[model samples]
Target: MNDLGRIEDLPADYVEEMRKVNLVPLWPSLRGVLPPLKPKPQTRATMWAYADIKPLLLKAGELTPIEKAERRVLVLANPGHGLDKMQASPAMYLGMQLLLPGEWAPSHRHTPNAVRMIVEGEGAYTTVDGEKCPMSRGDLILTPTGLWHEHGHDGTDAVVWLDVLDLPLVYYMEASYHINGERQPIKPDRGDRAYAGGGMVPTPIFERSHKAYPMLRYPWDEARSALLRLGQDRQDLDCIQITYVNPETGNDAENILGFYALMLRPGQTLRLPARSPSCVFHVIEGGADVKIDEQSFALTEADTCCSPGYTPVTLHNRHADKPTFVFMADESPLHRKLGVYEVRN
Candidate 1:
């Protein structure tokens, strides 16, 4: 602590210079922006995001048993692409995964909070804290950091989902972990037979205090429908534009991070206002003229556009009206973590 004293600012004189430049006069000067609105910038992140999984997955699927099992895998992120394989964000990484059926990722759990949202498929089970959660389309399942969890699909089908965590957050916090989980002989608990089809509410339980995600699944159907409706109305600047919100609060899920689905309505040139946050868009169904920082790129179904945050972003609907819808996610969380988030206007 003694060695660090010199690093602290000298206060009055350091800020008093603001007057010399006339940036702020007297009354509304240094004191006005006191204490800083957010935390100090921790570090610059090594930006690594890309979208070219189909070809990779296809080639792998042909040889491996994933396809034979009627399952598929598309790695949304991984260290090979700059995303730490085990950690999500620097501060959080419940663990990243893409699983299909007739295969088991093995039983394992560690002290890293994690969760999964079923992107596609049905009848997959994720046992957490000894409580087996059967996953279905739109279902959200949690494997609290170190709680024992295993995945398996005995049904006549396969499943897929998006995984999120404090991985990046964890790595940033410098609390990353690695573990080899034990293989359990059987399913831990099958007590909640009622909540078989996902949606946590329908399931019965004994002790509810030690909790998990309040809901089993955050449905993308309603969200998708809403965007579709907005597209149908030919509203303002939407090929399809809508933001992700936390269901309980009805506010943006996380101030630093947000999501929007854009569906273009044929020949629709959706103009995206320049944003302070970098955005990544995954083409769900259609195409566009994804332009960023003045360079143009074509984005088709299953393609992706990852723009550097605060970098100018613009889009033009090239397809003649069939409608182009995409799912957008961003590092507003990262920006907030850095404490420099704001809008010029």
Candidate 2:
């Protein structure tokens, strides 16, 4: 129709003139009546905050070798809730994970991105792809995009960690796969300790890894003592949100993944910087009212929350006399790589 209409004369009916031709790239123009191309309504998917929140507790006796600590996971954006499945996007899949003493989550691997923030525990380690990193409370471990990994609690104290994966993101894409290795968990050999950290030497960068950081572990202890020390001064450096960095260069570990810890002192409320990459956080220690887009929601240890990539989010320590801590993860780095990650600020 566009061609015929554009021409001075047509030999056949307007509809008949178009029937013999195949659709082209500009199909919308076929009708000859310009259908104005409007930007898809600027919509940020639905955000599930407070109200219908239910946090489950994974109890001790119920755990098996495959799981420990009476594993409890609170589903936030799930297909069951009249919402899209969590695996559709990389920013989703926020689960609170806990493991009791003597329990182990044996070896396994998958195609989705995953990370764990030690909520509480003394000795537990997640061997990623093949590298083993010691798991201590507040530690951050990265299982970038498609690495295989497993968790084991070898310490005398119970171990708890929040497992945040791109499950919902993968679910949406339907690009998910998993493999279970033998149940045995072993420390990485000295030469193969790349997953834990040896800097760039351990990172697999074969072009494909471009825009994707594969380092698997980000420990919280590294930031813990420093936070405590800074707490003494309690000045401008308050609420240090140190992005999980490449241990060797001291540069923000430019992995496709990102993780951080927030230290909240009593009465202190941290206003999350605008353009936060759709943060996913698990309460590691203490409880507080986390304000997202100005709405306050109470969160305690083991509870998880998800914020859209570009929105206002805040963390306020409600505990009058205690310090509250949390671990946050996001795929903003990856999005930045794709040239699609942006903040409103």
Candidate 3:
């Protein structure tokens, strides 16, 4: 590659004139925008232990009340993106949100799509577009763009969940905002029950539902059973994984990000190929070791970590007698939509 001319090489007066006209030279910064080979992502290999986060979260609950805080959260921001930006990757935002007993987070809707992965506690539920979805350990609940959602807790313990959102991308497009709304009346039916079976769906011969999101909540019990069945049936497979999809359309659960559940057999080590989309991993059960580039993270239950794009990752089950399960969120849908998705061995 030839060395491009530096901005300093240009005449000082000419540079000032271009600056005054709101015009700048491209050659000096062309390589930065269009780098050679794969992209130079700012997202780094980072991890956050639940053990370290829980204490501070409980302290936050004691310090602030629900009325003043609205949603009490501690962001899991990536150092590569700068802590102030509150982003895990270029396109994803992660935060650990807490709700104490008898608390209710008011209803509101935002332009960015969001999901909640329940980390601990019980008797907490999220109401989205009217349907009330219960929160349990390992459950995933979706709050798509422009849909009203709120959280409430009935149990006597603290409820915490990992929140994943495409806020950076939506904010970058200048379409990020939220509208507060009054409390919603609970609906009669839930989407998960309507589409529980794998190969079956409501016929809707008389009338079809026009809602964009047919399913709002995915139970952890169902997902774990599916993984166990897959592992039993496919003993030869190295990686036991399942993608969360829209049962009616067989597409990714959400529009912008891909969600998956991965199971590692007892004492198994799985190597995932380098892919174009950055990924976030959260341990749901057991313990595991995650390696990305030169960084390594020992993730136990409720621990979260992220890896950049164009880098292969390795996962190893720390237990020798039992399996390990992990929840993963990635930017594949956005990458594919932009026609740049890739996987390299």
Give all TM-scores, in the order shown: 0.58, 0.66, 0.98
> Can you tell me which runs of candidate 3 are displaced by over 4 Å?
204-209
Q: lDDT by residue for model 1 over 1-345, one digit each (tens)?
A: 112232134467765786578754443434333425432222222222224553454455456674354224444443423543543233332212346456666666655455565545676777665566777654445555556777777765545555555556555567757565665555444433433332343334534443433232334565567777776676664445776543333454443345566677778766665555546655656677777666778876545545544455667777885766776666565566688666532
Best by the lDDT measure: 3
- After superposing candidate 2 on the true structure, give the runs of residues whose Cα lies further than 4 Å from its correct spot: 1-55, 59-74, 78-84, 87-90, 98-103, 155-158, 170-174, 183-215, 230-234, 249-254, 320-322
Instruction: Report lDDT (CA) for all predictions.
Output: 0.53, 0.60, 0.95
| CA displacement after TM-score superposition, residue 280 of candidate 2 (Å) | 1.9
Error of 2 at 224 (Å): 1.2
Task: Encode model 3's per-residue lDDT on 1-345: one tens digit a residue.
Answer: 747989999999999999999999999988998999879999999999999999999999999999999999999999999999999999999999999999999999999999999999999999999999999999999999999999999998999999999999999999999999999999998999988888987786212346778899999999999999999999999989999998777889999999999999999999999999999999999999999988999999999999999999999999999999999999999999999999999
Return model 1's CA RMSD, one decimal. Answer: 9.9
TM-score, prediction 1: 0.58
User: Which order, best to worst by TM-score?
Assistant: 3, 2, 1
Better of 1 and 2 by TM-score: 2
